[model samples]
Target chain A: MEKGSRRSFLVFSINWATALIGGVLSLAAGIPLIGFAISPAFKKGESKWVDLGLADRLKNSRFKKVDYTFTAKDGWVKATKKRSVYVTDAGNGQWSVFSRTCSHLGCLVRWDDQKESFLCPCHGAVFDQNGIVVAGPPPRPLQKLQTKVEAGILYVKDF
Target chain B: MGFLNERLPLTEFSAHLRKPLPKHINLLFSLGSLAMFLLLLQAATGAFLALYYSPSPEHAHNAVTYISEEVPFGSFVRGLHHWGASAMVVIVFVHLLRVVIYSSYKAPRELTWIVGVLLLLVVLGFGFTGYLLPWDEKAYWATVVGVEIASTAPILGVFVAKVLRGGSEIGAVTLARFYAVHTIWLPWLAFGLVGVHLFFVRYYGSSGTPQNTPEEMKTGKPFYPDQVFEDVVGMLILFIVLAAVALFIPVPLEDVADPTNANYDPRPEWYFLFLFQLLKYFQGPLEIVGTFVIPTVGIVLLLFLPFLDKSERAVLWKRPVALTVTTVCVAGIVGLTLLGASSPKLETADATIVQEVPQPTEDIQKTATLDTETAEVEKEEEVFDFQLTEEEIEGTEEEEEVFDFQLTEEELQ
Candidate 1:
């Protein structure tokens, strides 16, 4: 009985070894095929919500201009930067955050109170209160940042 | 001896099938097979993409960027998949033309031809769904056109649009619905239909010339060693070409999507550019007819082509009428695409132009600087006086007042 058990163990070991080797080889061969299949799912860079600043500075008006700085780490390198924005209300206490990034062609936008809009000085692209293109060569309205208020501090996610 | 040889065993059968196939299977014959190969490649790459892609608008674009930049070999894989899809569309159309020119849709192969037509529609459907997955402006507006097209479908237009969008407009539901159709539903249908079509082709064995002429007819070699070898070589060549394109010229990404922006010149993907341009020439009733009616009619005509052209001859040169029709169609598509690419720019209204505010003269700037310093000193004094008191932050009221001013008139001029 002991001799029989030893033989069975040897057979099992050989089978297991063969299966393991086969599985590894199959995976190696299949990698390219699998990569071809799933390549469409891969995306290069993602837009992340970069924090802008505190909410206390943005109260009591339909629009508020606030500037804030944050550090971004790509791989091992870290850099600090500041961005300014105009946050307006879409009614009901909710805010629509506009990137001063001009819709005309990436120029900085300034608030022209007389025009009641964000004015792109570069090509004269004008956006109304809702950020619709009111005038100029700008193909689109201003980019809006996703925002949230935390503990009286305004935080915006910049793309 | 002849009967004994004909009733050969498995080994003999294998040996008999190992002969060289015909050499005359032209470049046109290759498009369908190439399309099929690319479809498989798309499915594989798309699956990998789906693993990491988030359908939610909040994360969709970011996820795409992440896969491109962060994932291992992600960019190459995504690029291959994207370019592969575009290539498949081109090849499928070419394949259809090849069939038409050769009059391969006659009697015995009618069903095969019909299946091929459906496959073309599936390819377009794939292009449409895949275009919107990136959630870019181009994708968004192209989808707007798609939704608009669906809404023009008479009694069921509204229902179709709602079902496709998952709601009234493009949103999370629309994204999810598109994702499902793109990655799941359409793929299964395409695979099954393609499989049946291919199986029938093999069974019928190349429907060669039904009306064989002694001079025009050529006996083909077997399909194994000859045709299979050529197919393998073709696949390798296609791979090399695709790799070169993907590496040398990466797909372009448009600016992020913002629905509030109306000035964006939203164009569909290049594959649909012809259709997009077609809509421009159409006005009111003509728009509906050109955009929806004409395309539908074309598709139906293609489906019933076998009956329309009941020629027995399979030699492409013998089918002059069909060949001419196919050539015209190809030329028309190519011309329309070129026109679409060079579409005339839409005129912008003058009222929307924002005027820049001129800076005051240097002397005025110095005066404003003095005024700002005085105001700062006064503000400091007020803060010092109110330090012990629980008075709210000063100037908040003034800031509120300034914000209330409508800056429209000054901006417009």
Candidate 2:
């Protein structure tokens, strides 16, 4: 078998063919699997410009707590979620909305009027009016939500 | 020419590279090399991932998201890394099994066997630590359970758990520590052990097979072309399979680590499911038996196997006791892992943990005090429910509705 030309050729083809087939088949199954796996990573945390009522009601340079409900599309099912934000008038018709959820551990944060800071009771994390961490173990400032105003109506994104 | 030749052993090295092995070498023999290839693949893909991965809790999940979504071929590389690690685990186990069945860990190869065991432990450590780097709910909770299990070790339980976690809880410190161990520590350990294992293999040469007689071993074929060709073919097949798996069944990255989400069920990676299953049988004080004693005994037995099986005959039939014991252990692992995988998670006694805090609710009211500079705070204690019911825990209904098997909701979004 070693000396025979046709036999050696057959052996060579078989060996290489096995490898080629394996490579081809793996790709056939793998490409779609990989595509399916990575699809979620590409999904941007989408939010809609949900109306938060009259923009005129929000006082200039003052923070107001706003609560709004929107249907959140979570994968296949959509659920009506009640979300809150702190909307502060930016002096010139613009409003900065901050998510009420604390940046530290997802616990809800409350504006402590006496303390003059947003306080998280879970770990005593404190944030200033601008949403920056004032004290404690909160890594960063509270997440600010995208806000928009149109025709005196205030709106905030669910992102 | 003489000086150059003397400085480098190129001629001798070339001669050594082409050294022959017994012609009886088969595809099964190539499993170890295939495992080696997968390890290299993991290292390469891991390096690519590390370029974007941030170990801190704040950016770890975001970094992973960026890698998979933003960087070109980042998802592809990540998919390869995820699936490749799983494949490596399987191949490493199979390779170990093959070594056992072949009785190749006998006599002069005792050191090789011991080193191989250490390598397996390192591979397992890599899986455990890497599992946490994703910083997802599953990763977070699973590490919590894993660390808790470690803390159950008799005298050194708390110490070991503290060392593994870097603190009392799974947080930023834990994530950074795990990242360091997985990327820097385990790879170095594997490389060092692999170098020594290869040295032993070369120094002793191929053990060939028990089937091959002394005379047959003398007339073996060269390692470079014949055996190397078989290895190449095997690796190609493995690559194709790995690629298909990566492409078709990419691993899911669940929601970022949220300790508050009680709905999430914590399960270990598939390899540890057997031991995870074992823990179910012995609860409370006897938990140590499951976590420490049984596993310790099993590993001790495996380490001392070469000495225990004193028979010179390497044939499977000749070693009845060894064969039965190995078969039983393998069967136990498979059975337990499958059982654990299929079993619905048992309910914990306290699913809901409530924390009281003053929070802004559906309504807010502000009052002016005497000073008026700082508004009078309304202290309202609200109960934040973190408990999940059995109904919520069984979330498979919605996940099944989206895609049968192609992608889970978590993977989809």
Candidate 3:
């Protein structure tokens, strides 16, 4: 037998029609499945402000580790979650708050007083006291959080 | 043999095994069979690991730790799965390189080559998904960065990341999703594609050696002892090397995942380090270029190579264009991997100058950016001077460029 044999018109049309029917049926079910799977992307993370403590007291502290819990929505589950941040007093009325999370990869950075720098054990990424990249492969400085001091209370926004 | 021949197709199989192979075929031709051997090894070990493995953010780390520390030869099996993964990637790539060098992917073997490339991708998919199963800090964070990188793709990035993550965050669902894909979906895909690949291989029959003529191949030895023996030997060597690696360098499991730990590092597995490092060169909106465009184009071009390479030339040096393309790509991947591997490992002299616990933000940048100030500061005490990146300099340098700094900073350097 030779290669590249041509098929009859009936067979050609039937094959094409069969594929069309299959595609239509598959798409009819596949679209909804895809939509259901991707539904989470459409939903935004719930954000709220978790109060830390008094703003004045938080100011001028070398590096105060502040852990706080807040009610938040994670996927379909809504519950209370605990989070932490480093609060350092920026000379003046300004209080600088930095999220201990490394900006590169989400690794918790520990404040090493011996090194006097925020050290990321995961990648050896060093962040200076002010949350600036002193060394290693952090793409950006330690993530600085949005801070608001109301009256005598200190608060950092958490998601 | 006589008893089995009566009950099974043993005689026919033995007859099939005696198929003729080109005499010119050598060790390089055995890489395909070696790759398949590694796949089988992976499948067997992965099944065993899955029996004890738990896929959840809460228990996955514990499960892996238990397997590594408690179970007899568990660490060995886990290590095989881990190192075997990298070995598989390496062997598969080398096999492809061999195919390219010889014109084996040409003509009737085009479908086989295409399917082979797809199989390589499935292997890579396994690597990506498997990295998340341990659910340790490293696994969790690396997957976070990986998913984030996925989210950087244009149009469908969000959907892609969410689907990969199985939800809004990399938590229990993400682990389960990765586990299912790694243990189930990928194996099925690999097995199916491998079947197609093997079928095509048999259908096309060896493209024969690039140097030999079909007439010469007619006078070659049968596949029974010559080729199969070589294939088995290659596999034996691979297994020995793999065992040595697993015994000496067991895979590490870092601290358990903590959602609230802001200081967690998100370094991707080594196989993905090249892509992770590639993203460093791209910033902001340009991330899509590195994340999606380049990879998509690379895959498409790789898929179409057999069609494009009309040069039926088989010898490595005969095709100048193919040689150059392969050289550049191999160099790029190697260079990028080296760069990615070395990322986040930089250590410098400690600043014993007063505890900068609350160091002035400018002081940190000034010491790193200014050579003169660093010299002056070093006069008093040892201080680590860090060169600022262009992005960092732009953010803080304009106010301090009076130090007469170069526009270029050691970003990657």
Candidate 2 per-residue C-alpha lDDT over B271-358 given as tens digits, one digit per residue, 9 for 90 to 100: 8889767866663346577767998888888887788887874766568888898879989999999987875642322221222112
| CAPRI quality of model 1 | incorrect
Docking class of 2: incorrect
Better of 1 and 2 by DockQ: 1
Tens-digit lDDT track of model 3 for B1-413:
67877899987778877888776877788888988999999999999999899986657889999999999999999999999999999999999999988878888788999999999999999988988898877777777777766776778877888788876667666777789889888999999999999999877777667888878765577887988888898888889999999999979998887665544446677777778777666543454677778999999999988899988757778888888999999898989888888776424222222111121244543443346533343232223222343455676767676775565666536
Could you report the Cα RMSD, in angstroms, for every candidate shown? 16.9, 20.0, 15.5
What TM-scores do the predictions have?
Answer: 0.60, 0.63, 0.75
TM-score of chain B of each: 0.78, 0.84, 0.81
Each model's iRMS: 15.7, 15.9, 13.7
Give the candidate order by descending lDDT. 3, 2, 1
Q: lDDT value for candidate 3?
A: 0.75
lDDT of 2 by residue, A1-159 (tens): 776799899999999999999999999999997665334334445445555655665656354555554444333324344456666788777678778666643455666555667765333467898888877555568998877654444556655
DockQ of each: 0.02, 0.02, 0.12
The residue-by-residue lDDT of candidate 1 on B303-408, one tens digit each, is: 9988888766566667678768777877888888898888754334113222111212234333323454333422322222111111222445656777886778
Q: Quote model 1's TM-score for chain B.
A: 0.78
Q: Residue B398, candidate 2: how far off, in angstroms?
A: 36
Q: What DockQ number belongs to candidate 2?
A: 0.02
| Candidate 1 wrongly placed segments (more than 4 Å) | A1-159, B1-24, B208-218, B314-320, B347-413
